[model samples]
Target: MIYTVTLNPSIDYVVYPDEPIQLGQLNRISKHHKYPGGKGINVSRILSELAIESTALGFVGGFTGDFLKQQLQDRAVSTAFVEVEEDTRINVKIKGESETEINGAGPHITPEKQAELVSKFRQLKQGDIVVLAGSKPSGLPGDFYQQLIRLITEKGASFIIDTTGDELMQSLEHQPFLIKPNRDELEELYETVIDSKEAVVQYGRDLLNKGARHVIVSMGKDGAMLFTHEGIYHGSAKPGRLVNSVGAGDSMVAGFTGTFEQTKDIKEAFRYSLACGSATAFSEDLAVKEDIEKVLQTITIKQWEE
Candidate 1:
């Protein structure tokens, strides 16, 4: 079974306006909708669209938490998470000429509540893939990913981590099975801006040297690069217009891990990942199986010789 962890989840309330807004005038919302959102939640949603079953883990509380779980259950995705004291937060996304996001601080997980998560993870055995996705909530320790990686590794189950900045930097020592960092994240890690494909691939190898088993540097629209001890592989994105870039990288991670869990072929998995990402980029929401398959047929994989 595949498992995904979303330490902090939120209900994304998206508001769209029909007309331009005046500086001092009150703008009326023409349409608004709420969706279950979070990096891990998006990953699980994509996995479900692919006909793969996955269990979502994390801390949820109050009515919003109940709604989030109901949304997931409505989509046919299973979840096993602990409850906390505070209510889950809601993020307001105002879409107009430009998108504006107001994110909220979620519930705090006490040490005992956090321990319950660890105990739940301990039940996984070999062949089960665990994905620790997204950032830690406020009041949680910084080394949270590091701790989960160690725990899953100790249980003999391979793990995939998708986070950037310090959360990713601190977990490198655990040597996760895979780590997906986008181009900006790659630049941040090396403290240098990458201008060419060669520089991106080179820096990807640098992460492997730092103890990451496999490093995937995702370049939106340009595609993604996969670096391992074996060699460097490049997958091209299918030609498509970008409707929404949100969760595209997370979908790539989900597609790669989801396919890898079945095929275990790095290159094939990357191709599927590219398609999944591009598919999501071409839509306003995460891609479904048909959406992903359409692009999968056109995605081309090229091997770069060092």
Candidate 2:
């Protein structure tokens, strides 16, 4: 079984203003929508689109948490979130001339609640994949993710971490099954600018040397590259308008991990990763099966060479 952990989930409230947003003024929106918002949640939602069953695990609370849970349930996604005292956060995304976001800090998780969440992982067995994504809520220990990784590793289950900076760097030592870091995050990780494909390949290989079993460096419209012990592969989707970029990376992670888990084909997983990401980028929300199928028709993968 696959499990996705979202330590801090939210209700992404997207509002489209009739006109450009003005500062410190009464602004009105033409339309709005809300959905469960968290990196891990996005992965689970995308996995569902591929007919892959994954249980979402994380912290959720209050009326807001209730809504987020129902949203996932409505989408036919299973969840096992720990309830907290404070209400789950609401992130406001203003889509005007450009997208602007105001994110909430999320609820504080007490140690008792933290231990309760950790106990759930003890049930995991070999062949299980746990995807740990998004940021940690306030008041938890800094090593919270590391603690979970230890338990997961001890249980013989694999993990995939989608985060940045030190937290991401720290997870590398555990030899995660996969890690998807974008071009910018890559540059930030090594503190060097990637001006050419060679630079991208260099840093990507460095990540592999550092202990990542498989590394995928996403370069947005420029496409993505997959680095494995066997060889390197690259693929991209045909050009299309960008509607939303919120869950594109999470969609890619879900695509590659779910497909590879089932088929164990790296190239096919890379292809689906590109298609899933592109489909999501071209839609207002995460792509569905039909959308993924349509985009998959335009995807092609080839050996990446200098």
Candidate 3:
């Protein structure tokens, strides 16, 4: 089984403005839409699109949480979220001449609630994959993710972590099943400018040497590269107009992890990863199964030689 953890989830409210807005003045929007918003939740939703069953685990509360939960349930995605006292957050995205975002702080998770979420991990067994994504809610210990990694590793299950900065650096020692870092995040991790493909391969190998079992460096329109112990592979899909950027990375992570688990074929997984990401990029929202299939037809993966 695959489990995705989203510690802080939200209802993403996207509003479209009829015209340019003036500061400090009343503005009106032509339309708006709401969707369950969280990195891990996005993965589970993408996995469902691939016909793979996954259970979403995280913290949720109040009416906003209810709306988020219902949204997932309606998509046939299972969730095992811990309820909290305060209501879950609502993130507002205003789309005018430019996009602007206002994110919420989310609910605080008490110790008891934290322990409850940990206990759920105890049930994980070998062959299960746990995807830990996004940031945790406030009030939890900084080592919360580390603790969960220990439990997951002890149970013999593999894990994938998609985060940035120190949290990402810290997880390498446990040897996560996979880690997907975009070009910018990769540069930020090593604190160096990567101006060439050679630099990318060098730094990607550095991540492998640091203990990541598998690493994928996503470079937007430039395509993505996969680094494994055996060799490196590069993948790309036919170019398409970019409609949305949100959730594209999570979709890639889900595509690679889910397909790899089932087929154990790195090339196939990389192909699906590119297709899923491109499909999402070409859609107003996350890609559906049909969209993925359409994009898959344009995907190409080749072994990369240095």
Clashing residue pairs for model 1: none
Per-residue accuracy of model 3 over 144-197 as CA lDDT, tens digit each: 999999999999999999999999999999999899999999999999999888
RMSD of each: 1.5, 1.1, 0.9
**lDDT of each candidate versus the true structure:** 0.87, 0.94, 0.94
lDDT tens readout by residue for model 2, 146-169: 999999999999999999999999
lDDT of candidate model 1 versus the reference: 0.87
Model 1 lDDT per residue over 89-162, tens place: 89998888888889999998899998899899789898888888887899888777777888888889988888
**Which ranges of candidate 1 are over 4 A from the true structure?**
22-25
Q: How well does each candidate superpose onto the true structure, as a TM-score?
A: 0.95, 0.97, 0.98
Answer with 2 or 3, whichever has the higher TM-score.
3
By lDDT, the better pick of 1 and 2 is 2
